[model samples]
Target: MQGILVSILVGLCTGVGALPFLFIKKVPQALKDGLLGFASGIMVFASSFNLIQPALKDGNLLSVIGGIIIGTMILTFIEHLIPHTHTKNYDENDDSSVLKKNILLAIAVAIHNVPEGFAIGVGYGTGNVSTGLSLALAIGVQNIPEGLVVAAPLIEGGYPRGKALLFSFLTGIGEPIAAAIGFFAARLTDKLLPFILSIAAGAMFYVVSHELIPESHCNNNEMLATYGFIIGLILMIIFRTVIGE
Candidate 1:
């Protein structure tokens, strides 16, 4: 019960992040690049250490590899079926295009969030609420930047502040929902934990490599972005050490 509550509270950080955009007029491109790079680093670290490494410990190498490959393929299928564009290309004059890009990014973030929620749920389902709380706390803190990532661009692209924040909030709702589902799923198939974890890591890897990295380095602040990535990577490690089991 406590674990579930913590997860919801952590998820709420998404809204906290959007609160800043409500008062700000414009988001600098360098800041955006740095934020994106930070996110990418966190993703890479979490996917590799927190997720995939555990799978390697518990599951056969082949199964873990297969899970990763299949996960990547699933995201690839989504990419083709629904195109995603950066905030830059779409003109503010074209409301439809701007909205489309916003929606796409929202969906992408939502998809990426599912596995994280599941991991939290799995922690609770496994009767380790302490670890779940730690994981949720880390995710919640990370979601702050994600909220900025989601809402800032929409503001720049012409969406009303309230509407942009709403969209960002929507992306976060996926976490609690997925958390519930993950708890149930984990209880039913505890033995399959490693495979499931591996798959989620793979999906995250795809997101970082395909979306976050390119977006961060797309502009002139490439070095700043790299520095941001290092900081994020270190943060993730520290997060795991301090709060995680």
Candidate 2:
């Protein structure tokens, strides 16, 4: 129950992040790329330090490796199966293009949130309050940028602010659902915890490499994206240090 509540709060951070879009009518391309980059960096750190490292410590190498492979495959399969728009030529004037891109972004973000929710669930299910809280905190913070990533393009593409924000918030709804599943699964089998953790990490890695990084660097905002990534990384490091202390 507590875990689910925490997961809900973490998931809602996506909506919270989108709150800024209410007042701002247009989002700059550079800012959008930077937000995406920031999200990528946060996910990378969470995947490494929060998920995979801990899994390695708690479970065997084989399980961890297998989980990672399975996780990556799952995401790959979803990407291939889903019919969403993907293109480098994003013309804000083209309503069709904008709609397709927004759909794609929403799908990607929703998919990414599942593993994050699972991580949170696994942490709490393992009876580690600190672990659960840390995962929630990291994911929650990262979700802000993710929300912006979802809402910005829609707004730029001429979608109403209310609709953009709704879409962004809706994409995060998957997290709580996945969190419930993870919590139950973790409670059922302690032996699978590490593998599950690794799976979540792998999924996040896929999102960063396949979705976030590419999107961030696509529009000649590579420098801003890179800096955003660096800032996110540093922020995570600081968070970890403070938490450790």
Candidate 3:
């Protein structure tokens, strides 16, 4: 129970991290794209290096691959269900509905966060504190852009700064809900653990490749975004190795 609470608090911190956006009048497009790209790189590297390789070491390559495919398919299915919209810069001729765009962005970010929190909760429940913390912090860091993604549209939509920021912050609450579910499920059945963790790894990989990478390209220099991504991966490796997660 304590572990679950801790996980929820950790997840909630991701939402709190968005508080700063309430004061920003305008955010730079290039900055958003660059950060998003960097995050994508981190997610990809983490999935491959940390998640997939570890599963392979456990002699579960088939499950790992299946998990990846399943995760990717889930995202693809969701994308088909609801078309995502980007928050474009305000222009005289633009017809974008800011509210609709932000809402969609929130949903997309929430989808990604659910798997992340699950990974964290499962890690902690199974006595893998280092792994859980690393995953949570990494996922949280990556979520900053998600907050911005939500905030930009709300701000553009003419909402008060506070309301926009509040909306952005609220979108990330799914992480804790995921954590609670994962932790409780693991407590109920240990055999299901590997599948859940692998599924999360797969989902995160899908999100990075399908969503974050493309968003990065849209808002920043591709080369710089790529550089940031590499840095994110390296940092993840360093943390994992040094912390022995």
Candidate 2 vs. true structure, TM-score: 0.93
For model 2, how does the per-residue alpha-carbon lDDT over 66-109 read when each residue is reduced to its tens digit? 99999899889988888454447667677887788788878888
Query: Residue by residue across 1-245, what tens digits does model 1's lDDT show?
Result: 55556667767777777888867957787987888888778778766876677678878898789878977997788788877876567676787877787788878777767767766676566565664665576577667777887888788776789888888887877777777876776578767877776776677788888888877776778998999889988998887887655
Top candidate by lDDT: 2
Give stretches of model 3 more than 4 Å off. 13-17, 86-92, 188-191
Q: How close is each model in CA RMSD to the real structure? A: 2.5, 1.7, 2.7
TM-scores of the models, in the order given: 0.86, 0.93, 0.86
Off by over 4 Å in 1: 1-3, 88-96
Better of 2 and 3 by lDDT: 2
Question: After best superposition, candidate 3 residue 51: deviation in angstroms?
Answer: 2.9
Candidate 3 structure quality by residue, lDDT tens digits, 159-245: 787877677666667777878777776567665555566776778887887778877776447787888788888888787788785
Candidate with top TM-score is 2
User: lDDT per model, in order?
Assistant: 0.75, 0.83, 0.69
Give the backbone clash total of model 1. 0
